[model samples]
Target: MEKRKFLVVVDPSHERHLALERMLDIVTQRRESIANFHLLVGFEGADKADPNAPSEVIRGKQWFDELMAPVDATGVDYTVEFFWTANWRKSITDAAERFECDTIMLCESSAEHKRGITDSKWDLVRQARCDVVIVDEGTEAPIKTILAAVNTQAKDAGHQALNDRILERGKFLAEYFNADYHVVNAYTDSENFPDRQKISRMSGLPREKIYRDMGKPEDVIAATAERIGADMVIIGISPRTGLSAKFASHTTEKVMEKITVDVVALN
Candidate 1:
């Protein structure tokens, strides 16, 4: 297994204190296994010096020096940078691209817009070229179990080549964290609930553990996490929107909101 490269975007909020600590723990534990580590901090550029003079840009170097005071030595080849930009999400995406990061972790910032027509994080997640992990910050402890909310492959659609790709990704993370992997294929009918057999077969999970639940996607994920005692819920992010609302099957913002368990969302 190749060590995954990670890019962590830090925010200026105090609530993010726990999130940063938790992130530090995860990175520290997997230091040896990480190929590259990048921490990016971005602050909004001043009004471009009255709109035409151009914004005062922070220099490229040592931006993270102050924040990384606690952990002097970050695992893997590490780099910290500071950027002054109007768009946080754009900065994150640009930095991740420049570093060729495989995964980017998003920490909600203190300056997060409470009521807005646009969501910065949502724009970033949807536009990211690489896998993105959207976090609410300072969740809980080490994840004991991760529930991967997978959609059934439309085998009859003639596009079901191997199996659901989400299944494989879910299994991979479960194995990576040494957490119990639960695959729940939901259905409305009690009779069809036994379709757990199909989900188990596809996910290579124990069938008896899968159950049928009829409810909103958020409800199902939250309920399953509580019932299964899962520490993290792994959901997918595809085609993110400005609102980033929990529109259903798999999305980052929704999973994070509905579950008390730490959410490990994947893109």
Candidate 2:
């Protein structure tokens, strides 16, 4: 999805500004206009938090201001809200939905890792039903390459794929970081459902440059990610609704079980 209004959630920690800067840089390079922006700061509740948050909001307003100043040449309209949230992920998802944000950005924290223990950003991505763009500690180094892992088949009426979302995201990344893009779609023929694979590729990409993996999706993504030396693996996830919850394959979750590379998920 093209970024219009991005939601950035952070505390006033040392790591906060850098992550915000990195995400802003990515948004800038995309040339996608942002209509509204929310910068939510979360911390433990205390007397200090109650009052300090407001003072910090006024004092640190320039942190975002100065970051935007350098990119002012882009002329992208943006408005910021220095707000507070008790639950980081819930706060971000709610603000994004309320503001109709196109993407979400947040710095990785110790608490964030704890959330991921069950499933990190996937929980947010799945629940929000929107594209989530996260900035990790290493995100600022310049994302030089992206590995888009998909599952498709050769026998279907359609061809293979290199996702447009992945490509668009990758193109934005490539331009910003001077990186190259690689498309990877891996599938194994299941006798029970052969056509499902073909439909998977058509969701967001052009059907070409197909890559085959002969086993489960988890194995395929891991091996392919290793083979290509990917900086991040962008995959698709289907949210578990009323009854399909039993069968949904969370590529992000499965891939996370095996690899340490960064992951981005779209639904």
Candidate 3:
């Protein structure tokens, strides 16, 4: 199998390099499966400034070099690049495309209570072409349990494909880390409760590992994740626009607010 490439977005303002730490942990554990990493340091509102002319850029490079000393000692093949753009979401997505990365790993920066419409982190989640892992800064390394939240009652082809994608990514991570894997499905009413057998077949997990409840998606997901002591939650997110985007919050965003674990969002 070909090695998987990762685009790790670094925040210069954050005192803790959580995203880079998470990526390093993954590389340490799964060195054989990982390809070279590309680190993108984001400098928002610096689009007009020349890359080499700014004193901030020079200071940022010095800080970045010191931060990368440990990475260099590990002998992991990696490269660092900086981006100065007002449109952070576009810069991240474009870099992902340019590098042909399989996944984008970044720290969660939105407010814990609610994510505003202007939150670029959530926008990055919606805009990125590859799988995006939003790592909570407080999350511990070496994930112990993974909860794959799925909407098994959806009959449409698009949702079905998304459900399958969620399971595939979740199961891959579970096996890779040798962690416990569980599936959670929430239903709105009796008529639409998820089929246990279908979920079992789709997830390839036993009956005992499946969690089914009748409630709102965010509530069920948050409660189940808390109950299971999940270290990470893998959920699917569909891009929204226009009125839908303005009036409502995505289930993924709501779940992020309610839970403290890391989230892997598949588009």
Candidate 4:
């Protein structure tokens, strides 16, 4: 298997390093598949502190070293960098592109403020070219079950491509962790319900493992995930523009609001 490069964004404000922990867990489980990890620790204060100052740089390095003690003990190859800019959302995507990372990992707290999703996080999700993993609070290693949310009713080429990507990534993760893989499709009413054989053929899972229900996408995904006791949910996010981007919320975001499990958003 080809190794994957990961860009992990670490927020300095949060006490819990959920992203780091999740990355470490992945590295531990699939060491050979990981090429290297780039750790980006953000300190959002360009006006207050001199980012280039020796004292500040030293402090940031010290904090990073302390936080990475466990990572170092694992003997995995990684590089650490600090960002002093307040525009961390752009910085994260920029770093990912610069490093040619396949995926970007962030903690749930970094995406939420006061129990609400932040615009900055949504911007990163929409702008990022690579996959994004939002590590939820209290997420542990060795994920037991992974639920892949798909829209089988999609007919457009773009939506079809996204469904294929979701299934492919979901299967990859399930194999990586040796976990149960399940696919879910939501319908508005009985007339639009997805076909079981089509879902099974698309997901390569038994019919019994495929979940189809009639409801809003978010509600069905949340309910199905809870019913199956999934540890992580993988969904696709299509980039929006203009009025839709401002007025509409992505289904992935709505699912994030409803579920406590980790989410992997594919573009």
TM-score of each: 0.76, 0.62, 0.88, 0.90
1-267, model 2: which lDDT tens digit per residue?
443677776665434464467556665655553465666655433344464444443345577566557546566555555544445457667778888877676543443353232443456666765666544444434466676665443333222332445545555544545665556655555453334345334433343333465677778777877776666667666434555543554545666556545566666
RMSD (Cα, Å) of model 2: 6.2
Winning model by TM-score: 4
- Kindly list the per-residue Cα lDDT of model 4 for residues 1-267, writing each as its tens digit: 678999998877677778899998998888888999999987555554565533433355577678999999989999878777778687898899899999999877642374445777777877789989888863567888999999888787878898999999999889878889999999998878798899898889999999999998889999999999899999888535576655435666787778787888887
User: In model 4, which runs have C-alpha deviations exceeding 4 angstroms?
Assistant: 49-62, 110-114, 239-250
Once fitted onto the true fold, the runs of candidate 1 whose alpha carbons sit more than 4 angstroms away are 13-15, 44-66, 73-76, 108-118, 153-163, 188-194, 238-253
How many clashes in candidate 1?
A: 1
Looking at model 2, report the run of 10 residues with the lowest lDDT sum: 153-162
Tell me the tens digit of each residue's lDDT in model 1 across 199-256: 8777787865665677655677778878888766666554334453345323345556
What are the per-model numbers of colliding residue pairs? 1, 1, 0, 0
**Candidates sorted on TM-score, descending:** 4, 3, 1, 2
Candidate order (lDDT): 4, 3, 1, 2
Please give the lDDT score at residue 89 for candidate 1: 77
How does model 2 score by TM-score? 0.62
Q: After superposition, how far is residue 83 of candidate 3 from its true place, in Å?
A: 1.4
Q: Rate the local accuracy (lDDT) of all candidates.
A: 0.60, 0.56, 0.81, 0.82
Looking at model 3, residue 233 earns an lDDT score of 93
